[model samples]
Target: MVRTVLVLGGTAEARRLAEALAEAGDRLRVVTSLAGRVSRPHLPPGEVRIGGFDGVEGLTAWLREERVDAVVDATHPFAARVTASAAAATSALGLPFLVLRRPGWRQAEEDDWRWVGSVAEAAELLPTVGTRALLTVGRQELEPFTRLSDVWLLARSIEQPNVPIEAVLGRGPFAVESELELLDDHDIDVLVTKDSGGDDAKLVAARRRNIPVVIVRRPPSPAVMIVSTVDQAAIWVIYGHATVS
Candidate 1:
């Protein structure tokens, strides 16, 4: 029997999960949903849908309408609302749900890191730490830091940020060499970023420069079965159980 799976995607893991599931041949029907936030996103293999499902009500209706047998949320960790809605919608439908969350970066002994609960809190703490900051917290989350008059800010984004801060546009999986160049060229004294996990180029660059880093912690997510790797998540989607890998 073929099962229809809905994957809430936007991250590299999500794409990888979709690719893995697509390799299942006729056994499974995979549909990946993107947030449509990026103007040009790297299209993943298999069927793809763009934009929001509105909220829990809309998501529940979509799931029902699509006849989705299971759900895997591999969205950005900071996407709290989307995650919450997915959890709620799946619960209401009694569907098998899984969360693919990459583990967050660990603070090394040499790294000077200030952990904050939210982006606003990080912005508040930035003034006390350094005069200039390199912000890698994405374009949407930059509003909180825009009001700071004392600290000079340089931000990076896939698209231009709405705020007045100076920004360099680029997409991720950024190399440490490029990161080091960015830090050195800017004379950056501090780095502001979210705990998106996986790659740690910026973190490494900051450590090498002995610069302080203000890390915005991920928001609390709804309780769900979570797997830290694509292979584990793929196993869950296929066999309905997480096996030791």
Candidate 2:
């Protein structure tokens, strides 16, 4: 029987996992569910569904209706709500579930990293760090920084933010040289970002310029089986088990 796998996706790891599963032959039916937050999102291979599945009830119904055999959540680390909903829905159905989360960035001794629990905490600490700040915590996350009248905030996002702040529109896998130029051009003394983990180009730029960074730590998540790499996630989906070490 061809088992159907449902991937709750958004991040780069999710995209890569879809590609990996697509190449694994005809034993699996791969369906990726996107949150549709990005206007022009990079799509994955196989079948795709956009938007939320409402809450736990909606998702549970969808899973039952679609007959999803296994679920893999490859969403952003900050997307705790979706993760929780997926966990609950899958648990109630007694279906196989996995979380594919990439490891967070490590701080070198030379890197001046100020870790905060939330965006609000980062907002409170921003003024003390520097006068000019580069906010890379997504467009929706820019509200807290908006209230900081004393600090000059420049936010870079894939889409234009509704909030009042200087905007730089771009996407990632950014080169370090370009990031260096952006920091230099903006006269950014400090940087505020989330610990999204992969691609340390911006962090490298900050370190080169000797700028302190206010990084928002990821929130606590529900206990579930998790793997850090796409290979592990693919293994779990295919073989029903992943060697987590």
Candidate 3:
């Protein structure tokens, strides 16, 4: 019997896991769901569905309607609401659930680091720390920095932002050499990033230069089995299906 899997994906790991599952066999059907926020999203493997599912109740209804055998959440680490909704929906439906979360970034010896719990905290620290800054965090939270008119922000995002601050439009999966160049070009004295750690080379480069990084902590996830990689998630999916078979 064929099994269907619903993957709540927006991260690199989600795309990788969906591809792996597709290559595994014909017995399993994979559908990857993406939040329609990114302007031109890199397409993932298998079937792709874009946009939100209303909320937890909506997600639960969709899961049942689609007959999803399992769920793998690969959202951004700071995506607290969707993750919580997915967990609640899966639990209510009595469906198998797994989380594919990339590990958080760690502080290095060469780094000048100040950890903060949220974006607001990081924004508050910018005045005391540096005047010229690079806000590596996404465009959505750019509003908080508006209050800090004294600080010069070189903000990077996929598209041009309408925020009051100076913005640069670009994409990432950035190389360390390029990141270093960007740091120099922007005259960035301080960096702000979230702890969603699928990529590390850039962070490592920042650390090597002794640039202060104010890392926003990841929100706590619901109680569920967590795996660090796409391969690990694929293994869990196959194993869970085997048991059901």
Candidate 1: stretches off by over 4 Å: 241-245
Error of 1 at 188 (Å): 0.5
lDDT of 3 by residue, 3-49 (tens): 89989888888888988999879888999999988878988888999
Q: Mark the regions of model 3 whose C-alpha exceeds 4 Å error after superposition.
A: 241-245
Over the full model, what C-alpha lDDT does candidate 2 score relative to the true structure? 0.94
The per-model lDDT (C-alpha) reads 0.92, 0.94, 0.85
lDDT of 2 by residue, 205-238 (tens): 9999999999999988679988899998998988
Error of 2 at 31 (Å): 0.7
Q: Model 2: C-alpha RMSD to truth?
A: 0.9
Deviation in Å, model 2, residue 191 alpha carbon: 0.2
Task: Quote the lDDT for 190 in model 1.
Answer: 95
Q: List the residue pairs that clash in candidate 3.
A: none
Regions more than 4 Å wrong, model 2: 242-244
Q: Write the per-residue lDDT of candidate 1 for residues 1-245, one digit (tens) a residue.
A: 88999999999999999999988888899999999989899888989999999899999999999999999999999999999999999999999888899999999999999999999999999999999899999898899998899999999999999989999999888899999999999999999999999999989989999999999998986778888999999989888655435
User: What order do you get sorting by lDDT, best first?
Assistant: 2, 1, 3
In TM-score terms, candidate 2 sits at 0.98
Worst 10 residues of 3 by lDDT: 236-245
Instruction: Tell me each candidate's TM-score.
Output: 0.97, 0.98, 0.95
- What is the Å distance of residue 1 in model 2 from its true position? 1.1
